[model samples]
Target: MSKFKYLIDGIVKNNPTFVLVLGMCPTLATTTSAVNGMGMGLATMAVLLCSNMVISLLAPVIPNKVRIPCYIVVIAAFVTVVQLVMQAYTPGLYETLGIFIPLIVVNCIVLGRAEAFANKHSVLESALDGLGIGIGFTLALTCIGLVREVLGNLSAFENKFSSSDGMLVFVLAPGAFLVLGYLMVLFNKLKDRKKKA
Candidate 1:
């Protein structure tokens, strides 16, 4: 019941991307393609899950004055591990993501969860929170990336959709903002309708 609320909150009511609007850096920078978006999402999710668990375990031991710094150290350690693994196994995606991978160390979603949720909750709850938020973030990015890829590159899931004809702009930085803005508007409208119903 209440234990599961944290998970649902992250995915629906308090989504890191759509609702909370946290972690915009990677959301905007690494989502140039569907694959890139999924890659970035999973990488961030891994760090989020691990860090949240570890932070929860250490919360009682950490001093209040130095908690933030301690959280950063824990988060950075996980990010480093993820980075090395990505570089070793997924070299292409690793290269595509570039600095954004390491940038996850400072992602607001990670820090926010660490400080706001994990520090106050049990290990299982914190892990679930991280997983839910990570999934939400991943889904949002994947949707945006899928749309951009289809419109910008005329491709989806490695398959070409209309003979390589595309808007080109949809693949750029401005396009990310444009798509995200429209999606946000649409999402809000849907939520309003749901509430009314």
Candidate 2:
């Protein structure tokens, strides 16, 4: 039950998006469409999962003075794997994500997990944390992408419901901020209500 809490905490309480508010760059940039958002989210998840387990296994041997660098090297290795896999099989998404794919190395969510949770926890716990946080992040991105695509492109999952554009601004950078802000508010309200109950 204690181990499972690590998983649940990430998805709801410590969500990288709405709660902790980590990884804002990719959260905003890669979510222009649901496909792109999911692609990025999955790629990040893969890296996070692999890196977390590896970091947990290696934490004991890593010297305290250089733990950060060691963690980053582990993360970068996983990110490279994800990038190569995406480029080979999903070239379109690979192209769409562009530099952001490589930029996952610096994403606060991944690194923060490594330093904060993975290093201190067992491999199974770390893996759960990574998976839960990854799922939360993916859901957040997908929801934002869905909203943006539906409103901005007048489509859902690329299916056009209206011949005319919905709201062009929702597809732009400004729209990303607006949607994120609104969603943050909504999430907080729901969580607040849940707490009150």
Candidate 3:
């Protein structure tokens, strides 16, 4: 009910990544670097916010059966905007991010929020949801990215293609899966303890 509660709810209790478990594609891909993770997160946030606002506007008119397709159209439009802008300005990120950029359209987190929270809520509240979930996704990816970069490349978020430093053999795709699995287990245990306390 408080203003800060909205903010906290978005980032913590209702985190899209750790809590809702959406958007696993970019979560697994561009998260190799803090920068990459941040970029993807922000891009997705922009699209989410835009789509949420539009969906909220059209919620009354959109047929329930066709709502899914409508959401995709809105999301795809925003994602195309991101792809073009990124390709034009941040070509390096464009290259590094690769197919994942386009994949944001299908990201469960984006579409899920659009269908669930955004359509039902006010535009402002939906924006808050997007902001909260987007930031949470960024933070989780950045944490994993930091860990992978440090242990695997002797740096935080070094180029995935270039291993200029010592290779710890635990930062690749398989290692990321291992780390994500362990992190999920650790988070689950923490959640259990929190409930107990």
Candidate 4:
């Protein structure tokens, strides 16, 4: 049904990272390691879910002229909550993500979902959309992080791949782009094959 479609769309068909290509800033910047990627993804997911639900609930009451600002305010509030909680509990990740944590306020995925999907959808639907997109984003980042980690640092999920040195470039900014680009190509090829069949 329509509800299921939203989930599928966000995860596979219109994934914010690979398919729609939104929020590339955090996608590229925070995915230096699997832990960092998952942390950033979860942080963004929390904000995305909260903002989507709140925005959907308030859409009717919010004035059209000021909706964007209102959405940003709501998102910023949630981002602050996530930031504080992470800082208090996960200081290492907090320090690793640093300014990017606060920068979630402007992530296009959150704002775009608020405007494009959440505002127009029911509360439940908005939440599901956020969840699906958030998961997809998380998975994408984790995969990229895993690849970079294994190849660049010879580790994954805290497991050592080898004592030998990995390709250092895979851990750098350029490595992020290289991995992401190739992943996009692979995803597109699979999608094309699916369509043809």
Summarize candidate 4's per-residue lDDT along 1-197 as a digit string, tens digits. 87888887888887999889999999999888898999999999899999999999999999899999999999999999999999999999999999999999989999999999999999999999999999999999999888889889999987886999889999998999999999899999998999999
Angstrom error of the Cα, residue 2, model 1: value is: 3.1
Superposed model 4: Cα runs more than 4 Å off = none
User: In the order shown, what is each candidate's alpha-carbon RMSD?
Assistant: 0.8, 0.8, 2.7, 0.9
TM-score of 1: 0.98
Q: lDDT for every model?
A: 0.92, 0.94, 0.80, 0.93
Candidate 4, after superposition: displacement of residue 135 in Å? 0.5
lDDT of 1 by residue, 99-147 (tens): 9988999899999999899999999999999999999999998988888
* Candidate 4 or 2, higher lDDT: 2
Single out the weakest 10-residue window by summed lDDT for candidate 2. Answer: 33-42
Error of 3 at 42 (Å): 1.5
lDDT of model number 1 = 0.92
After TM-score superposition, the amount by which residue 97's alpha carbon in candidate 4 deviates from its true location, in angstroms, is 0.9
- Give the poorly placed runs of model 2, Cα more than 4 Å off: none
Candidate 1 regions exceeding 4 Å error are none
**Order of models, best lDDT first:** 2, 4, 1, 3
Report the lDDT of model 3 for residue 95. Answer: 93
TM-score of every model versus the real structure: 0.98, 0.98, 0.90, 0.97
Clashing pairs in 2: none
Candidate 3: worst-modelled 10 consecutive residues by lDDT: 158-167
lDDT of 3 by residue, 75-131 (tens): 999999999999999999899889999999899988898877888888777777777
